[model samples]
Target: MKTYHGSCHCGAVKFRIVSPEITSGVRCNCSICQRKGALMTPHIYSPDDLVIESGEDQLSVYQFGTGVAKHYFCKVCGIYPFHQTMRKAGYYRVNVGCLEGVEPLQLQVEVFDGKRL
Candidate 1:
């Protein structure tokens, strides 16, 4: 596992999560995802694997569709940094774009058919 530090645009929310190898991230064609244009790295992590370094109160939550995944973003910056995937039995999916010094577009991407739902 590798550690990645992430934060919102305005640096209001900062966090770290352990990811496996991180060769790729998921690009879902779902309505919300398409609108947000976020490259998601849905790493399977136990709740303890994530550490919120600061700005917990600056975050806001959004949910849609089946309301399974709870997307968390910074209220001030409006950046989706991570989400709790209820569809995957309750694991966290961190937004690799928010990670420090990481170029999300350089990673291999697997597309999911979320629009079919």
Candidate 2:
């Protein structure tokens, strides 16, 4: 697995995800996700696979509905980079677009009916 580095726009929050270069990511049609334009790579890793290299304190979280999914962003830049999964403790859905040098459009996207779930 290749280790990829990512950070918020302002560089306040930085993290790493160990995985193959992504060929696809999950694109949820849920209300909030659609509105925020967040294209996530769901279940890419357990929490153990993600390492916050710096600015842990700069991260903020948002949740709604069941509140099981915890969306994490940089408090300083307001950039959404990842979220904790709803069903799996310590598993994360990462923002592929936020991964350094990743092209969001290049990812083959799978659509999830998150609104219906």
Candidate 3:
């Protein structure tokens, strides 16, 4: 496992996550995810695995439908850093594009059928 640093587009929201070195990602086909088009971590993470380094107050959350998922983004920069999964409420998935040293487009991504959830 490795510790990874991530931040929003404007650096207004910074955080860290401990997970295996990221070699792949997930692309969700849900309505909201389709609009955002962000590549996310392949595995869900527990809250304990994530640490907010700074800008906690600058984070904004958006929810719709059943409101099971909580999409969190930087209020200042409009960049989504992570989100609470709808499949499991307290679990999270980090945005690969937001992580330092990660090239989201280079990742071999799996398509998730989130639209049916």
lDDT (CA) per prediction:
0.84, 0.84, 0.94
Judging by lDDT, tell me the better candidate of 1 and 3: 3
- Residues 65-111 of candidate 2 have per-residue lDDT tens digits of 88888889898989998888766755888888788878888878899
My TM-score estimates for the predictions, one after another, are 0.89, 0.91, 0.97
RMSD of each: 1.5, 1.4, 0.7
Model 1 residue 4 lDDT?
84
Per-residue CA lDDT of model 3 for 1-117, tens digit only, reads: 999999999998899999999999999999999999999999788999989999999999999999999999898989999999999999999999999988988999999999899
Model 3, which residues run further than 4 Å from truth?
Answer: none
For candidate 2, the 10 contiguous residues with the lowest summed lDDT are 39-48
Best by lDDT: 3
Ranked by TM-score from best down, the candidates are 3, 2, 1
- Candidate 1 ranges with C-alpha deviation above 4 Å: none
Residue range 1-117, candidate 1, lDDT tens digits: 788898999999999988777778898887888998888885667688878899999989888778888889899979998888756746788888999867887899999887776
lDDT for model 1 comes to 0.84
Per model, state how many residue pairs clash. 0, 1, 0
